[model samples]
Target: MIAIFGSGETSPAMTSVHQELIARVSDPQLNAVLLDTPFGFQENADEIATRTIAYFREHVGCEIRLASYRHGGRATALEFEQFLSRLGNANYVFAGPGSPTYALRHWHDGAVRERLRAKLRQGGCVAFASAAAIGLGAYALPVYEIYKVGADPSWTEGLDLLGEVGVRCAVIPHYDNREGGTHDTRFCYMGEPRLRLLESMLPEDVLILGVDEYTACIIDFEAQSVTVRGRGGVTVRRRGTDRRWQRTTFALSELSHPQVAPAAVPDSASGRPEPDGTDGSPMVEQAREWGAHGRDALDRRDVDGVVAAILETENVLNAWAADLVGTDERDRVRAEMRNLVVRLGDLVRGGGREGVREYVAPLIDVLLSLRGEARREQRFKDADRLRAILAQCGVEVQDTPSGTAWSLQSQN
Candidate 1:
């Protein structure tokens, strides 16, 4: 059940979109659950939830569960798990908008992850708004860091239940209005530097799906089309081999049936697993082979080849994620997989620019080593310096009486 929606930054449009989706489902009598992943003090969260419930009750004759996490505090893994379990029984689930990083940090591991996966496996339809939509990819670029947080934008790991897929896309929520004036223009959301940075991070083959505000790229799996349901068209960008971006625009209907063929198998001995069942013939086998090839290319640091392999593997995985897990778990896994990609990116790019911006495991090793060898004054100075360096690398250091610990800063 592939679906997408956008309502700009307004609550009314969002509420309407929710109602429309619930009404569109085949079974109006089935229960539709609303999972609110709102940021702190979200004024519209309750309204959106209430309207969604009303729509479900009045139109669909169903109940709605307005699930919300604690504000300014991380939602426990157990809470997420319960939410996913509820989703498994839901006819539809809608994710509220907020900080993608915050929502992810809360739901990455444990029962929530598993439950989401289960929902997707069961082919449950799901909808995501704003941050949740951005987070619904193999990787999510935290654009809020540049736009709202006034910090260097960086990518974080997302749930990987989506497997090895990367949209490498940038979504601009309100593409129509210059409501924030020139100072806060749409260009601010798609700054030149950020576009360049995103280009540098992605392979040439990765496609950028840019959605305008108030518009949505509604993907229909059964129909194999991506119809634009709102007011804007989808923008596609293909960075050339010469490191140049080539931009083009396609009406929503044009992308509704973009041609994408099944993957082909590589002519190698150590290929991917072959299909055993009669139903799983050429296409499935080819995808498995491509996945193996992609994994090998990744190990060899063949960026272009790895990207190709990932794309092919993703095509196969999308079906797997959609059919086996449903949309919610697929979305969750996509987030986790993206987090892995960020880690992979760090490895590919020879570690991050910030010296202390290594992976958690390596950073912990370095900190432990430094802490072990320091004299009294040296210890203080080294710890302070390390903390400062970590901060510059987007890490927050907390020195408790027992020991020092760290966490990634809020990506806004």
Candidate 2:
């Protein structure tokens, strides 16, 4: 699926530009589906949804499905799964603008991500705006940098539905909109320094595609080209001993193949074949096999097997993490570890203590911050009571030099 981004949809010019692009690829008699996953500026969601529906109806004469998800916080609804199932048969899917962090926090591994991957692989076209555009790549940028979350503005592992296709390619949407909010409006979304910092974090071969508002980098896999449609040119950054920038008008034929070949996992890192084992799986492969078995066991009501499988997965992930330490690939491995935790949480929900703790860690950090602040300002009684309350909920608190930390002592 190819994604698009713009500054904002409040303007008629942006909407018209998007409409024309859709018209270019859409057919009147064919049914096309648009999925609007707008997590940022939700107040404008209804307007954007209405405009999108109207655009397709007036131009393409195709049916549009507005899968408007307001809050994708946790525990995805089965209704969303059904919504994605519907998209599997769609001709086109478009996600609306929003915060990439929020969207990824909510939808990364849920039913929506799976459906999107399925649609793209089936040769369907997908367009994403703003946050959704960021979601289209392999990493979700922490756009909300002022927030504590932004301090780390490190890339989180995205759906991986696109595999390594968009790795190191940071999609700076609204690149030319100086009127848009933020200091990095012109150079980078954050600023030149921060952009450079981000670049330094990425592999040397990664490219930055700074697309202007109302413009799109249309990637056609079939044609093996990336064409620029609308008002702006695409910026290509090749950084080595020195950084070189090139601004070129693109056509649908340019971006068919990656500028650099996708990185491959080392054979030693790749699982070794089992000796006397028919599956010919390596250690990592065996670990994944056990993880899948655990998921299946959970689905089939074999709670005991699920527990065993989850522990085995954890061990494998830990070993993988150890191997990746101090390497450039550490963050990626850590992200995968987090994913494993999430998957394990899904399987063991209401099953036991381990399951609950896995799900509670992130939430616990948020709560501890609140409690720590209260205590720091001499609200000792309130802080102590809050801590006690958390203890009642099966959490144990430990005071640290940095702040207060907590962990689940037992799962109910």
Candidate 3:
């Protein structure tokens, strides 16, 4: 059985979903394993993992261990093998809330999918939610790149776990997102604009499997059944058309044979995940000169003064990231309290939140680390090469007193 949750994986709303899925586990002794790969790029990955474990321990009545596999490039051979073992050996596997592209980049290149396939094939529950759910399809959307970084609409090869089970389509979670309030953030934040563009780009054989927020679409391959549970329901969009299975429990066989709909009402209603709180160190709030302050670079030739205003934004981002994770600041603070998850919520929705600001600072430090190494070794050529690399990638690196900062120049 494959349980796909649209969102709210760790929220109180999802406790029943977790409990029910665990109940379905045939194993006498449940060994729940959490795949921490998707969100591994996060600086506070350890904290997230800890909170998740606690969530399971407290609410779900299951003690789950983390299978920490963050970056594929950074993992050793033994580390990769160990990751594979954790999935293969576990009866109930759960992964949620991370970058689809990041997880795809790591899993599709290796045997992670196969291990998952084997686990499902041999009969066990594998629940993947949110961003992880998006990767279980024939094609994957580069959500952050296209929606946030201003990249062109495109698709990347996915794990195709859905195709293995006879569903030829992309799995788009958060299908009913409305966090944008004033903007169209539906269709996984691609909006109708980019989504329509990308829909035309899909292969004829593939369709779209969209699950609504706070919903779970559980597929039982053996009995050939699909049960929709939660506040919202499932949506299976056919190629280039508006055909979909909006609500109600349906047969899994219906996927291979989608029928004509009688003017089905669209799935647009969405609910925000309940905030999970984390205690964070108090960060001094600063005045807003974000767009202007970052532009005061001393000189292009002055490497010491070179910085990116974006990184300063990222510092504020890092400070506030913890507050968003389990904290209900919306009741106290307003706009400023909106951290990474909420930022991620509506960031790609409107015309205003464009460029790479949507991605926060996933890879900025990696580039800075390389440049720092070059400068420490007095390798001026290598340091210059790093700058060129940033420039070519459309990142504008400028000077700041605290450190070097960067932002994405419009790729268009």
Candidate with top lDDT is 3
Candidate 3 per-residue lDDT over residues 1-412, each given as its tens digit: 8888887677655678789888878467787899988889988788778878888887778899888799989999999888888888888998887789999888865578888888778788889988888888889988888878998999998888887678988888877766555566677887665676787889888888888776789888887888888767777676545545444667887876677464233344422322223211122222123313433332222211223433444454443432222333222221232222222222223233334353435545655665787688898886787676666555578868987888766533
How would you encode candidate 1's per-residue C-alpha lDDT over 129-244 as one tens digit per residue?
56666665555667677677777765666554333222334443333323333232332264434555665676444444455555565554434444555544444444411111
Better of 2 and 3 by lDDT: 3
Better of 1 and 3 by lDDT: 3
Question: What residue runs in model 3 are displaced by over 4 Å at the alpha carbon?
Answer: 243-247, 262-412
Error of 3 at 404 (Å): 40
**Residue lDDT tens for model 2, 121-200:** 65567777666676665555676653335585466655554343433455666555442222333432554445556667
TM for every model, in the order presented, reads 0.50, 0.52, 0.65
Model 3 lDDT, residue 165, Cα: 73
Could you tell which candidate, 1 or 2, scores higher by TM-score? 2
**Model 2 ranges with Cα > 4 A deviation:** 8-29, 40-44, 58-63, 73-77, 147-152, 160-168, 180-184, 240-412
